[model samples]
Target: MIKPVKGFSRLSKKEKIEWLAGTYLKDQPDDVETLKQYWNEDTRLQQLHDEFTENTLSNFYLPFGLAPNFRINDRLFAVPMTIEESSVIAAASKAAKFWLDRGGFKATVINTVKKGQVHFTYKGDKKKLQNYFDKIKPVLLESVKPITANMEKRGGGVLSIDLRDKTDELENYYQLHCRFDTKDSMGANFINSCLEKFADVFEAEAQRYEEFTAEEANLEIIMSILSNYVPECLVRAEVSCPVSELSEDTEMSGEEFAEKFLQAIKIAEIEPYRAVTHNKGIMNGIDAVVLATGNDFRAVEAGIHAYASKDGKYSSLTHASIENGEFKFWLEIPLALGTVGGLTSLHPLVKLALDILQKPSAIELMKIVAVAGLAQNFAAVRSLITTGIQQGHMKMHLMNILNQHKATKEEKAKIVDFFQHNTVTHSSVVEQLEKMRKG
Candidate 1:
């Protein structure tokens, strides 16, 4: 049995690797070499990556690709995407080129308000608590002025603060709900710092409020943190053209395609089962951009899914409609992204990705990210409505299948040619490769 190791973090990089290899990978010498193979040759660069997180280990890598010809808001972009999945970039690029002549994509930032909360338990008189809260609201805002000053100079800062009573749900539970405009930063650390200060000041002020009795004045501070769910921080991206314009390259006419597409989206909007996977495809586009740009994809993912279920039932984030002889496809999604802090200035690849994007501000980044998602959904639905999804997807997945079976270069070329006119399945690819080798 393996025993727990102490001071693992104190171990040097070499020592850590040795310990891991000896303890866990005892019989796997090749796996040990594989771990060291991925390390950066530049010592400084490798050190920087090592410092990114605890337990310094070899770096994991994903392909950083670009889907070009994305014309958003009259400007063109080769949106950077860092994902390992095959065909995501291809699908996005296909969709972008399809819309390039059809007025491209239009995106707008709806709002940019983020939120945080200070949860506390106060078993005091409800009326007196309300009175005291009213008296201290300004004080709560005033206490965080020093922290918000720099954010304010950038035209982003604390918006408002309100005390919410939730005693009915849990005994004596209450929250100091706060709103903020973080501008060009994701502002997780900033919002969290301000929230902690607010909690400190609120707790300190409660003791001084004479209107509150002993029980009311002693508010137990629970936790103070920023919320990932920012419904108001939204952006809308859309593509629209005459119904006849959607007929390019597909077997179905524009009108038939539009009707089928609309029906598909409507099903996603109403059915949770389909909506989950439907939205996941959208995230395949959104998350790639989010990760490539060094923003928090997990936070963005959480906020977006919450917004999808905002009406109490999880549904599609993308919607479509054909109105007035025109077909429109669009989505309004909440994305809190930043281009000024965190990994934006840290990671080398992240900086390059931002530079490729023309170094957009938070709002511009939001618009671009939303458009990626919209374009991705358009490609997916378009494929689903005509020629089926696998025709394109399995084609993109062909190389992966070939590589998995260790096909040589010449074998890969011949096999790829054969599949162009034949359906691609794992068994079929293996069978063809075996037949060729036998010959």
Candidate 2:
């Protein structure tokens, strides 16, 4: 067992990962050996270690940190984030703190159910299908009942089912949409499992006609389906900061800054380049927190990106403005995360992070994550409006660079000071550290 730090009663997952990774880097052991030492399952960790060593190891090691002092819907908490991009942590923390200086933040999330789509292609007679609605619809919907019993027990089940036809795009093809209430789980696996039953139901109903051959009729079911970003069953967060706290650091009036921020929002709506990076800033904090908590970051990323272009045009995910002379921020994302399954159960460090959170349900986890997304967005927009993103991130990057060079703490400070003064170069950092070492 590893020893705990003196002051840290509850280290977040990012912290735990850092502690283990830093130890591994210091010891510089074989990858497999490193995996075996900290991770529970040697076999599983070894595979991950190999994959990480060969590919995307650089992507994996981005500096992960936590934004502290967040009060979401009157609950005090900290948000775990992993990012290499500069100023995100500082910006998020400052935005959160700004709200706290008022009455603290009040963030509320809906029931947190995610919709799973089941797509299929049927190039049968769309004209004849107009005469076949009742028979096919009831049977198809009924077939999913048994599969949804467990979900019903947990107070969630099949909420609704929808169907659409697209003959203009693809000839003689239609789409079947299955909208299920996943309860507290991401429900991708569960939803796909029920698709076969639904397909069987449809096939049996259609087989009544001699011409309706599922095989010969060219029928295919596309599982791992897509989700629509509907306003109903949406996750929304509203953060308000009081004008009193705006005076703490006043190069410009809070009202003046708010107007400038509002103008930037209008600009981002029209500019694709700014919107892309702007949304990325929101994800930087969000993806880290999700990954740290053992949620599927890929699905979340896909959903958010898809939601960005919902208007048939690209736009920023976040909207900020100075409302009534106080900063008001709003964000919406379909974060389909589950608290009690998969990696949360298998991973050692994930369990440790959950224990620190001490939330009772999956909905609670969603609330925190949504709030983190908002905090991250707030931090980013504030940075862009103020001193730019680089000034804050460069310091942290220097610390990492210093650590990589094995510079002593004093040497790190000296080199970092030199770095702040001018552009930092690896050779220059090494030479400076060497001179500091000798001196």
Candidate 3:
């Protein structure tokens, strides 16, 4: 029988990931050739190569487990996240437990709507093109009726359609914006379909020379693409944890703890090097989920990094504190992902992960991922403040170092002891371990 996570005291460092993943895949097929084949499907190998060559890979896999005790918006969920940094899963789990003692994370999503742009360049006179959309707004909306019917039946659909005149020095183009509900998916394909459906109408309306005569408006449909994904829609989560839960022996004050915590983070905010790693920790959580769900990590990565340096230079990705002596954390990042079709369906294991989630739509998954990111950020900042960052992390590293050379348990223990006692001299430690094994 699967055991319930009690707390930090009961956790075993060696089996952390296996425990956290729970019924999730334990031993992913270790056959390198087979694994390489799996990874190569859908040009993933090329992308990974590009990423690796860019020197952007920071091996961020740690066995940090966030214990369950959360109920978000009256629903129970077991959130599993993979990240390599100490304290993130622990801190988030701690904060979540505090909230569980009260109510849970009260959250709501605005709408799962996204915008796609269709750019049309024409000599139909920029002013005339503008008037065309203005005149056909009702017709376009009417045409969207059939497209949106299914979404409407499911309680979502087209909220509005907009057009704007963007004139380049060389030529003029009209951008048509279609805002529609993606239902439970990312809605990219659906949005693209809607735009294609309007192609005939758009061409007829912007008709230039029929067979090379009468009119002279050279209409060209350059690109029908999605917008930059402005998050006009949102999923907001507010968890009110009782202050009583976080206190220790002398009845530690949550407000005071939070204030001190904020002060430490303020230091990271002021320093660039610290900010880079600090922000990387936040992405640790976000990217892990993006990877696990087979979602586009690149889009989320671009959006977040861009958001961090929005004012110019990059900075932290989360804001956390205590309100009324209760911990409160908020994180915002551009999360453009789909739970339906495409990669989500293409991979077999991906489907299994989603099945474990038992979530109905992409929005629910996004909320869970957002929570993980906040949890991870909290874990990172808290560790930096309370203990020196290297302490917990180095201990884990010791295991990896000892695992090198296929060291036996006793050899591993000896090496760790020597390292901890400051007697480690790389060549000496390895020679000693080998000598002991030979004897």
Candidate 4:
């Protein structure tokens, strides 16, 4: 069994790695060296990465790739994606090129509202609480002025505050529901600061209110935090073309493929199992961009999945339809992204990724991110309704398997040619590679 060590963080880098390798990694020399190899050669850069979070270790790297020829809102963009999964960028690129001449993609920002709350308990007259809230609303807003000053100048700050009665569901429970315009930020820290201040003012003012009974004045503040469920901070992205365009290179006729595509989407929409994986396909694109751009991918995932189940049952995030001889596919998702803060300014790759994207504002990035998802879903659905998914995914995954076997450049070239007409499966690729190796 493993045991904790004192001042683990104070240990020198070499000693830390030595201890970790000795304890958990069996002290494997090559594995320990491999971990050391990933450290940045520049000590300053390594220190920056080390200070990013608590524990200090070698860098964990993911491939940062680009999907070219994305045309959104009449502008061309080569979107950057950072993810470990294979086939995501390839699928997104293929879809982007597919829609390049078919009016490209269209995206619109629906809204940019964010939220936070202060949870408290009051076991007094609800009528008195309401009147007290009405009286202290301005005071609560004013209490957070110092916290909101900078954000307010950025055209983002506290928008509204309300006291919500929730005693019906949980006895004596109420919430200080607050909303904000965070503009270009994810705004967790800002909103959270404001909420804490709101809680402070709320409880303090209650004590001073002449009409408040002793019980009412002693309300207990449970917690104050920003919500990741941002339904109002939404963006919609779409692609459409005449039905004839849907047949571009597929075997099925345009009309047949369009109807099949719609049917597939319908199944995902009304079915939970399919919708879960279906939405995951969309996130494969969205999360990559969110990660690459230094925004919070986990928060984006939580909010989006919450939105997926907004109507009760979790369903597809992307929608497809055929109307008036045209096939349309689109996705509307809530994404709270920031372009100027967090890792966006600190991480080297994140800065470069934003620059590669032409330094879009938060709104523009929202549209690009959503378009990436819509494009990804379009490619996934197109393959599913026609050739099936594994054909392309496994093909893209061939090189990963080859790398595992340490295939030489020459061997990889031959394997690539062999799979052009042949189906790709692990066993089949293994057999062929073995045969090639013997020869």
Candidate lDDT (C-alpha), each: 0.94, 0.67, 0.63, 0.92
Q: What does candidate 4's lDDT look like per residue over 207-322, in tens digits?
A: 99888889889989999999999999999999889998778788988998988899999999999999999999999999999999999999999999999999999999988888
Off by over 4 Å in 4: none
When 1 and 4 are scored with TM-score, the better candidate is 1
lDDT by residue (135-235, candidate 1, tens digit) is: 99888888989999999999989999888999889998999999999999999999999999999999999999989888888999999999999998989
Query: How many clashes (backbone N, Cα, C below 3 Å) per candidate?
Result: 0, 2, 3, 0
Task: Estimate the TM-score for candidate 2.
Answer: 0.79
Candidate 1 error regions (>4 Å): none
Cα shift from native, residue 186, model 1 (Å): 0.4
TM-score of 1: 0.99
Identify the superior model by TM-score, candidate 2 or candidate 4: 4
lDDT of 4 at 192: 92
Point to the candidate with the largest lDDT. 1
Runs of candidate 2 exceeding 4 Å displacement: 1-65, 82-87, 110-113, 209-233, 416-439
**At residue 97, what lDDT does model 1 achieve?**
100
RMSD of 2: 9.1
Model 3 agreement with the true structure over 176-294: per-residue lDDT tens digits: 77787676666666677777766556666555423322343446678787754546545555544555554442234655556666776676567778778887877776676666676
